[model samples]
Target: MKNFLNKVLQQHSLIYKLILYVLTVVLIVFLFPKGGKFKYDYFKGKPWLYENYYAPFNFAIQKSQETIDAEILEIEKNSTLYFKFDEALVQDVRSNFDERIRQENYTSEIVEEILPIGQKIISSIYDFGFIDSQSESKLTSETLEITLRKGNLAFNIPPDKFITSTELLQFISSSLANSAPVELRSSMLNILSEVIRANIHFDEEFTEKAKEERIKNLSYTTGFVAESELVILKGDIVEGKKLEALNSIRRELESQVWSESNYNWVVFGYSVLVALALLMLLLFLRKYRNDIYENSTKTTLIFLNIALMVFLVTVVVKIDVKYVYAVPLCILPIILKAFFDARLGLFAHVLTVLLLGFIVPNSFEFIFLQIIAGIVTILTVSELYRRVNLFISIGQITMIYMIAYIAFTIIQEGNIEELNWFYFRLFAFNGVLAFLVPFLIFLYEKVFGLVSDVSLLELSNTNSTLLRMLAEKAPGTFQHSMQVANLAEAAANEIGANAMLVRTGALYHDIGKMNNPMYFTENQSTNVNPHSDLSNVDSAGIIINHVIEGIELAKKNRLPDRIIDFIRTHHGTSLVYYFYMQEKNENPEQVAIEKFRYPGPNPFSKETAILMMCDAAEAASKSLKEPTAQAIDNLIEKIISKQMEDGQFMNADITFKDIVVVKKVLKKKVKNIYHVRIDYPE
Candidate 1:
């Protein structure tokens, strides 16, 4: 057994790697426990499929947060101010009045006249008591009262209601006659004002604690039912208190302690379902889009994005199930489409939405809307980096979501008025978030080294530093590259290949000619033939060196491998024919065909093969004497046929029909280039 285990461990084959990856992903999926699934997800006023439910336990009815908050607010409105009355305040005021009279040296007769007014003011206020100005609640104030708590005893007194602070002062002054002595008036007002102190204050801390207890004590469960009873018949619209009661029981059942047998079986079943979904994704990629599957970075990015979408749904659902629509799920397709092809984008989106259905409420509706939105995104989005395409595609996606959601709503509830307007806002917000695709594409390019259409578009510009330098140093080669780019792009567009990629590749294909510009005939403006002084072998050697030099130049300049591939495979294994034949005539027996060949990994993709055809056809076309449409057509046929004989396009995954289209397109384009122009009369 030990030896067998060692043997198995030592053999780390592709199958073993695949199993390891699947297991790792499954383990991650297992990490997020799928909570108990209730049969129906009910919002208020929605029809339910399940029969009437009954409470399984004697549980308190829980109140909704909105309901409890409203009641708590009302309790606060009705609450009266609390205070601690000072029994000694009255006695203290009397003593101060008597002492002031003695200190001022007032006559007994003057004191008798003023003392009544001062005492009357103090007595009237003291009888009423100084209450807190919770004076804003006038309607309640009329009937309002405060409790002056002294230990265990409480006294209820009418609240002091004053519209303004001046109300108290006005009452004091109005009690005196208008003709009264000024000294007596001033002395009486001053003396009375000093004795009045506010004995009542709002006890905020105590009131808050009381309100909280009352809110907490509110019933969470409104009603009860017995088990094995029909809570509602099938097809009943579960709403209002009925909906609330059913949800409470559902929560109870979800939270109920799982038995050893039940827990194991449910977990196992859930794991299998998750694993099956993952397996289907893998199999689809491996079968149809093997390029994505073979590249671990692409596969990892796909899985990670799906996992991220699922994780977002899980977290949002956990916080509040209603807000699940706001999680920006549209970002999944845009990001995937940016990095990969549209088919792969739609595939991953559908799979992710399906996986999240287990957790999301209304699984069928959620799946339908998302899948439709994803389809719209894939169909409408042509170039993700194009600002207009991204905006229009996102708009279409949002519209699809809105239309589909409304349709689903009408089908479910049979009313347009039942549609939730907030969901429309959420879908709109989701569409706006689709702008993240370009930024995410940038990050994916940086992290995974994946190229996107946006970067390809930027790279296609001829005014870029390297392309500009190539034009200046080797104008002939730059013009040739431009011709080849036009031909390749046309052919690519005709054959449903990536036209932008091939065009960008063609623009930089011959940059190595810049290193020794004068040696090539096109760049040599003088009649001097530099190759005439060298042996044919040496000349062929120089020509062959351009491929290696171009590769080095591309790498130094940090071009993508896709572009470098055109530089590498444009000549493929084709020879520098003129020099090779000249050398072979001198030493026919000793000449090796390999010596004249460009160091090549022949074209391995449709784009590279198209560039190869375009590059060779354009360069060879320059040699035609008496250029005509028929001559150009014959030349194109001869050159491309020769390349085919040499097995140049064996690995490019292009069909014979596609090659026919490319040949037709290239011939038409080349013919137009050399078409005769009649001279005009002077």
Candidate 2:
């Protein structure tokens, strides 16, 4: 049991990486829509690239959305408007007119004459139904006819057939003008006007119901394809009928309701594809970028960026697939390049684009356009600390996206006239969103404890508090650091290493000298040899203590681990030869070498190794009697060779070829410092 526990503990990092990988895969797969994928890929006006297709099952050929919308508009424009004819209300009006005459208690002859006249008016008003005044206002002169419903039966009535309140008043005035005296007409008008009521009303509910019924019965399918029928031949241009049939099939397949067993299989298929893509990314980091692979934090940052991009794209696709291009997928590579290298950044971007291809429509065009944009991001994005560079890079990425999309449209549509300007706006919006990368980099640095070039640029400023203190307390050491920084920067540029990082590291490598300025040789101004008054062992202890003191000072000032690495590794484990030899000569048999050594894990990266080379070369050059071309070259060669012999660079990821280049660069730089002219080789 103890042995099993030991093994588990020993392999804990590997187990953690496995867990992270599995979780990422599960999350990505869950984000994906659960649906069947149509196997065949086709585009309108583009050649069918697959084998000859036959109808797999009977499916109706669906019309385009434009066609369906046009048909609905036509139905709304010309469909019959309905109104209800109230026969019971007409009889009540007649009854009320007679009752009013009886209540007046008129003379019998007067009553008889007025009552018959009032009844005649009421019957005539209702004969051509009194349409409601509110309903009459909504109609235009163009409404020549309306349908009148009497219970189950419907009558097609002309506008002239129905009477409005205005028309009813006119009818009563005209009728009495011919039939009655002035006083009698006035009395009858008052009685009939009160009795007359509109019996026809616009049946808004029934009219809407009739319209909806017509719309619901509208045919969405223009034709049907039977099973085993030939749909399209290979290499045929998919257009018109062929395009519509293929689209109908695709819709039918995607919308199919899967059984429980089929649903599981569909999810399983998505899981396998997603896992393979992520696995490739893992293997790539393991084989070519082991440094990043070993660091779980860095690996997590890369995976996290990829997952966030996928999530953004998936959400946009769900909301509206047309806006998919506006997601700014190229931000992935740009951000990765800022924190890491271009190669890893591009690789991760491509893998992410591939995963997204499954979710977006037109997989080929989407993948192609995004991969190209990602490539442009890697090539153009640099100096992330400079805002102008990021803007310029994003501009180039947007232009590439627009050009690629235009080309795709021209090919598919066979004309520029049909090009979608909507996507160009999306690409522009994509460029606008890419401005958020710097903020994201800043956020990631704080959350993940990672440093980017932007932060490094801030640290590189000499006016920073720690750097200023070094100059004030140990001016000589500060000048030495400056010289070393120049030398390291040149060497790094020559060997294709991180020049900014190496230069920044070189400036802070000797900050320990600030604590005891007079102890170091560079800080001493007079011939007072404070070290000569002490024993060689005590002198060596003070010299070695500087390296230890530099580390504490670096941490106290909150320097990044990357910069502090230079302080720890600049002296490596090499012994302080001058102090060690002096003690050895004084006490022939009692000399211990470890007392004179600097505590170190040695240089473990190209930048740290470059700092080591430049630091030793710059300091030793100050001891020369006469600085000449040959003397400088020999001095550089000897110092580097001795350091190499001590295994100082064994752990560093640097090649001997890079070392040779660094040596040549240092030789030329040192010679230039003293104004020494080079002699032409024989």
Candidate 3:
């Protein structure tokens, strides 16, 4: 498992490393508990019940039971029947009926009355429910009488006034004494007994009605677990405590797991990935190493730049800072100038600015500002002739930054009043940071061995290290390269190509000419021509060996691949026509022109094609005498047209139109090089 993990880490890219860091942070924040407790309190008051049941009865005496019944019937004729009786008794048969009445009222008022009483009962039960188990009398009881009475007034008074204890008992006894039905008498007695035990009182009719209503609503107030029951006094405080304890335990468990988890592994993994990416970048740089240029310093600069990017990105996530996407943009140019050439820096800057949109996520406005500002920064510093002026670059960056901000605001349809300060601050911050660019370069160079685009320009000068070596060791080849540099640079500028590439390519194009210097025409002072003594095949072989020798020399010197590619592909597969023709004349129909061809993969790019055309045109134009504009134009046109026919431009991206422009520009430049002055006749 460890080996697999290490292998994966070794293969991971910078983007993958960044993604891992972000995921780790998310896991830490969300999956881990914050180690805080949660508490909640609930207060539930008891529901109340109102109304009560009561019995009403009257005494009656008669001569006979039949007479008494007839009198009750006459009384009932005037009033509604409101009693129950049993008819089986045969003694005196004097019967009187007693009726129990139940009161009906709104449930809310009933609840109000019952709640306080319920609360009292609950409190008593809680206080006494758990008496000593060892005791014989573990339960307690109490008895009190309740009275029921009808008011003299038509309307019912409040319950406290309408009923009295003496009245209820007296009414029950009197109803029993009369010729009352046994069933009615029994029911009244039972009700009186319960009322007495409860120690409460109510009007007869109202109490009976309330008892009936309570029975109907029994489901609302009964059958709850005794412990879980809530009354106004007890509230829900006990339940809340249990819930809070459960929550605290859950939180504690989460905190314990999070604190004990191996978080450092995540950090170590990400650090290792970053280290590996830096190592790869270093290896890539080393392949292009040059002794004359401080390659060590250049590699250091690149490393520091990558470190700064990682730092900035990490800080953004850690602090949760918002809307500073342009920070990466401000750092990119410095990085590009350090590791690669300045022209390549410009390209990288453009790509980096475009990528800022994805990095910032939904920040299109900032992305636009970065792109415009970056392009301006690169273009302002593009001219190799100008010294790097931080103030001027800042000024250009500031202008572009402001323009981008304003344009973004306008495009978004934002209000100027609301957004003006934001735009100003953004632009100001970026401008100030832009000024710090030069300082950053210095820091990069000091710490990381950075080489600036300005330094590269100085290195491209004629008196530079490689050029000096060439001049001292191979003067004729040096002169030849200088002439080629002039022509190629002019053609590059005229055709809107990379003039630096042309100039740099030209400078090293004939470093191969240095090997067997006298074997080539440029190094021969006298026309003794060593090749004159050799056979045509042997001479061609020696000439072809120079290209191979040049490649070997370039590698030993550790020249960049871009320069070496130019050296290898400049002649392409074009025939060494001069030598081929010489061999053909001697051998008649037997000589193979293919044998005399320069070993090449052909000019596979526009830069190499430019070098090839310029080298051939410059060398050929030297043979002209009394050169005129027309003559130079015709000569350049014929040379490039011959190369095109030979398929030298086949693999290159250069177009027919580009070739036409190259021809016209090369003609003008060659005419200037070979132009004649007025003759003074003797």
Candidate 4:
């Protein structure tokens, strides 16, 4: 059950799982129905339903009609009527007067002869008519008398009466004023007053004169005017129903817009999940931050840069696959190379390839290609050997990338022609990036400290600042270091260990000798040893002090921790056999082996174990008179066997088989250094 749970957890990302939980909560909250009903009545209709359905079109029409009726009533109260006639009326009057006179000779009497009489008679009749109806028949010999009736009949006049069209128009306007609404009546009254003031009138005389001639030729006619009453049009019931329906639809749409639904919950849940996943990723990166780079600031910056590059590539992938095909797996190796160790670069490559498998569609082929390219690039540049050219490493990486691409193409059954182009492009890109890495590293080193991976190579260089300092300060120690390095490197390679680390650690193993160089055997140029005058105990103390002193010197010099460990454990509680033998000969019973032994806690680590074995072997090999393969082999085996029997290799993880291999490799290396002599006739 425990394994099953762990396996299940491992199958999905922890980050993704955390996100999923948050998403689940969001989904539940959003999907939970607050009320039982799916629709709400409040928002069921169109927004403009009230405006369209209840607008008073009937009221507008009724108001307009009321305004028209009021105007007509006002006109009826104030309006008046008038009548007038012209020359045609005079001809009709003359004919009627001739018939009334019953004399044929009266027809020929010229109207010009009676014109002044007629004018006087008409003026007297108008004066009497305004005073009283009984006094209106005041006519001279040639003029006809006319009666004017008030209220009912407008005017009773002889046919010979003459009037202008303007006067007739004024009389008709007055009549209209009395019959229209007050407002209309007032306006008509004003028009009639103005016409009367201008001497314009319309009466029965004008009507009779107009009737005697052709209708088209009439000079004046009675004007009739009426205001049409306004009526309100009824509202459209169908329109009102349609508005309600629209409102219902709108309300339904609105409810849909704002309502909580499963789909909304799903979206909300997904969003929360995505956010949580991002947060988890950040936390995970933070926990392993130190593994990313030597320096925190540079590591963070490099990580951010890589993340940004990946994000950009992911966006591009979402847009189209043609541009950034690999989904940013290549960025991991580049970042590792720039900021961390080559081993880390390889790890990052694998991790990025796996991540790409999840992010990019159809990513397996690209992932395979990335892994191949990443391993080759990292391994090729892992070492900083001066003899290995930078361009050559880049060329190797490029070749690997091309080969991987070709292999992928072949596996996919791609055409050779297409694969060739793809291969060329892949090589070009990989080669450029790989070639540029060294220069970038060089620049980084100049600005920052040495990267841990290359620090071993730098320490191994003879011309290194620290090594040169060691050489100049303590030549005896430097020479001892050279011998020890040869042995340690050979032994390490045989035992499948880091030879560079072992060799570099050996080089600085005896740095403490610089404090008191003359007291050491290697630096004692004259045979008068500094320890000759001292007691055995005092001599042993001085020798023992070197180990402690070496640690302090290493610390002061800021040597790597591995070198310090090597210095601390190289002696591994082994007795100073030569000095012990000397003291034992003088006082066999009294002399203690512990008194001559180097202070140690035994070789507790592989590096220190190798260093201890190498230091002992190198020191013992110097006693051989004529070095030979058999003699070197015998020397190596004896040294290892003694150390083993003495329990010097107790704390070291080295097995007996490993020790044998170490001895053989040491023998080969030592024999080569001091090969058998060929006698010459010197």
Candidate 5:
């Protein structure tokens, strides 16, 4: 167990990466929501093209959401709120008023005389809410409920009505005799009004409780579905009540109870389906594209792309199944292909689509349309650098989606008129969103340190700041780079390597010469050689210093690591022959070959290896005084063959066959540069 844990923790190991891959895929699948899906996808106002749905079990038919919402709204609007009669409020009001009327600052005869009469009028009224009214109060104690603050004082009183404000005021006036002075009577009435306020308050808790009760008692279902009854018939338009019934059947089907025995099988099926799809992706990378499989960054990007697509579909389906078509499924393949190859992108997209099939409604149709769109995406994105290619490819993918959906609809309904136009707009919207893929690729490049052809194309531009400086400062070296770029690009194409990568690498390989342009022979335009004054060893140091300078410049410019690889390995540890021979003659025993050689980890890829050959062959061809076809051919063959003999191409994974192709392409390209013509013309 300790050994296994160590293996898992060793992130540098391939075994650890594989374990991470499995765990990540498992976790993503497990996070998916377990929602129900109907066998057939039916749209409102569309015909039911599939078989009829029957009551699968004795499940209760439920009301529609709209109906339930409307019922709840009505219950809230009509349900009366109960305000318990608080006897304490009335007592508090009476005590505050009695204390006020006794404070006799006016000391009037009428005020003192009518104070008791006012107190009697206020006390006679039990409900203090309507004491100032002129009309007579009319409330029975039966309907109205009264509540007190004392322990266990909650109770429902008999039916009773509340006292009107007019009635309470009239009672207060009548209790004050008419002949007992009008001024005193008016003052007594004002005192009665001061004590008047509502003892009754609305009870939210009781009102909400009673409202729920009313809603529950309301009839949820207007009708029932008999066992084996056809809820929706084939060829019938599914709208209005028919659509509602079909949805009810779906809800009922999902609500079915699962036994313990098959419950494990449900989980097992999901595990096998998700794992098998992901395993196919893993095995494909291991077998066909081990370079990508070996790198966890690229591997994670591919898997994460698939997981995100699945997650979007799963979440969208859960929210509303109709909007699932709006998901940019093609974007997955486009994104993966931008970072990797077409095969990987297509495989990952197909796997994701199949997994989503388990959850998306009408799974067959969804898979078919998406798989076709993914294929279209892969084909159109063969060259993704250009903006036009992106636009055209998205157009083609959208067209495929629209056409495939139409064909599927016709097949299912036996006519073209049943095709859903909304799905076409969804596909069009998906295409519009696909334009954002280039921007996404930019983000992935920054985050993952990946360099695609689009980036290479931009880097290869001669007008770029670095390359322009290389051109302005070291014109001869820049010209050499241009020639070498052509040769390397041709060789890469012939040998089935990344031609764009090699071309981009060739354009920047000699950028180090810009620092000491005149020290290099190509940039030295005159007979004067700076090396003539320096010692042989010192001159070799300067020659070797260019590679170091180029690496530093590339790093300073923040060029991608892949492009910098060209500057590092272009010479492939080859010694400066002229200086080395001079040093050997001066001091044979003291000569250090390492100082004369370019500091190199050597060419580590087929493209870098080809660049090495092209760089050497192009530079050497420029020195030939008597240029001929045989001479150029021999020069190209000799340089590459010697490098192969020195084992400089060992780590490049290139075969001798690929080397022969590179040599042939180089000879032809060099011949064209010198404009070699047939001798028969003379």
Candidate 6:
């Protein structure tokens, strides 16, 4: 039991990776639509490449969405508008009219005559049913008729037959114009205005309900497809009815309800496919990118990016499948290439696209477009810290999407007239969103405690806080660092290593020397050696402690670990020979060698190794009595060789050939620095 617990503790990284993989798989599968996918790939107007197809079961041939939409539009335009006829409202208006007449205290003869006229007007208005002006305006100008329902009977009448408020007043005025004198007619108009009400109101509820009933009656499927019926022959063009039939089967298969056993099988299938795609990514990392694979953080970043891309695409597909291309899948490759490398980025992008193929519509086109865009991203998006480069790359990617889509449309339709302008808009939108990559990278750096070239460029500036302090406190060491930076950068470029990384690392590698700058020979202006007063052991300790102090200072300043690596490894574990030998000769019996050595895990990458080589070569070249080409060459060889003998570069991923090329670069750069000229012939 103790051994089991110890084993679990020891393999925690592996366990974490396993958990990440499983969760990624589960999340992606969960994001996928809970439906079976059609196995065969088909396109309208394209030849059916598979064997003669048949309906697996009876299913109705579903109508196209355009057809269904057209049908609905027709129904909306021609459907009957309903209005409720209120028989009781007419009585209420009459009663109010009588009350108004009584309140006005009209003469009996005038009232008797006006009352009949008012009743006639009310009966006339209610005959066709008086409607509110608002409802009348809502009735389409082209609508010739409306259905007026009174009790259980519905009457189809011309919409103009119904009286609006304006018509009602006009009717009252015309009816009173002849029946009453001017004074009586004016008084009657005032009474009628208050009592008259719209007896027929638009029945929006009944209208909508009726429209819904009609729509429900509209056939979603035109005809039934019999089981085992030959749908389409192989090599037949998938057009018209054949296309419709094929699509109908696909729809039926996708939409059909699955039993518990079948549902579990489908879910399991999705899980397997998703797991396999991620597993391939893991295997590729393990085989070719073991450096990234071994570092759990880096591995997590890669998986997280993949999962993020998948999530974005899945969400978009869920909202609307046609807008699937609008997702900036290229951002994944752009970010990965910025932080890691192009190969890994492209590989991860391809895997992500392949996984998305299970969800997005037109899987072939989606996969092709995304993978192509990812490739373009990897190829074109260099130095992402530069805004213009990222913008230009995104433009190129957008153009590629537009061009590819146009080409596909031409192939599918045999013309450009049917090109979807909507997709082009989506692609443009996708490009706009890609501008977020830099901001996202900045966020990632903060979150993950990783550094990118952008941050490195910022640090490389001497004006930055920590670097400025280094320049102010230890000017000579700063100058030395600058020279080493140039040399290391040149060597890194020669060997195809991370030149910016090595250059930045070289700049801050010796920052610790600022603490006791004058103790070092370079910072002393006069013939004063601070080390002369101290015993050689203490002097060696001071010299060796710079690496340690540099690490502490870097941490205090919150320097990225990548830069701190140079400070930790510039001197490696080599002995401070001058002090060690001085102590050895004076007090040979008491000398302790370990006290003189720089604590180190050594340089573990090409960038760190380059810094180590350049730092040593630059500091040593200053000791040359007469700077000559041969003297410089011998100095470079001896120093590099001695360091090689001590196995300073064994752990670093630098080959002997890389070392030889780096040595050549260092020799040229050193000679240039010292102004070593060739001997003139007499």
Candidate 1 per-residue lDDT over residues 490-537, each given as its tens digit: 999999898888999999988888888888877988899999899888
Whole-model lDDT values for every prediction: 0.77, 0.89, 0.55, 0.56, 0.79, 0.88
Better of 5 and 6 by lDDT: 6
Candidate 4, residues 1-682, lDDT tens digits: the string is 9998888777655444444435433443343222222121121122322222322111111122224455555444332323322334334443443343333223344333333333333343343222212222223344343333333545556524433333444544444544443433343343333322111133445444434333334222122112232211223222233333433333233234334556566455545644454444445445654333233445444434444444655565556645454233454565466454465566645644554443343356667777776777666654444436556666776677667667655644434444647447745764564454556555555555434435668767888766787788778779989999988888887886767788888988887777788877778778888887887777777778888999998787777666687888888788877677878888889997778888787886566788887888887777788777777788878887887888977877678788778777777777777876689998
> What's the ranking of the predictions by TM-score, best on top?
1, 6, 2, 5, 3, 4
lDDT per residue as tens, model 6, 1-682: 9999999999998999999999999999888887667899998888999999988899888898878999999999899999888888888999998888877767788788778887887787777878887788778779988898898999898988877776677887898887777878888888888888887788999999999999999988878889999999999999888888888888776666566879888888889999999999999999988888988988988999988988988888778777887788888888888788889999999999999988876789888888888888888888766788878899999999999999889988888998879888999999999998889899989888888889999999999988888888888899999999999999988998888899999999999998999888888889989887998889998999888999999999999988999999998899999999988999989989899898897888999988888888999999999989999999999999999999999889899999999999999989988894689999
Which residue runs of candidate 6 sit more than 4 Å off their true CA positions? 1-34, 95-115, 165-195, 256-276, 308-328, 382-403, 413-448, 454-473, 482-500, 533-544, 552-558, 571-606, 609-682
Instruction: Using lDDT as the measure, name the better of candidate 2 and candidate 6.
Output: 2
Off by over 4 Å in 4: 1-348, 375-382, 386-390, 406-414, 417-423, 439-453, 493-496, 580-607, 624-631, 645-658, 676-682
Top candidate (TM-score)? 1
Model with the higher TM-score, candidate 1 or 6: 1
Cα deviation of 451 in candidate 5 (Å)? 2.1
CA lDDT of 51 in candidate 5? 74
Cα TM-score per model: 0.80, 0.77, 0.51, 0.50, 0.65, 0.79
Q: Where does candidate 2 have its weakest 10-residue lDDT segment?
A: 250-259
Tens digits of per-residue lDDT for model 5 on 586-662? 99999988888877888988899999999999999989998899999988878888888888998787888999888
Looking at candidate 3, the ten consecutive residues that score lowest on lDDT are 90-99
Model 2 stretches with alpha carbons more than 4 Å out: 65-220, 676-682
Better of 2 and 5 by lDDT: 2
Off by over 4 Å in 3: 1-311, 320-362, 375-381, 388-393, 403-456, 592-594
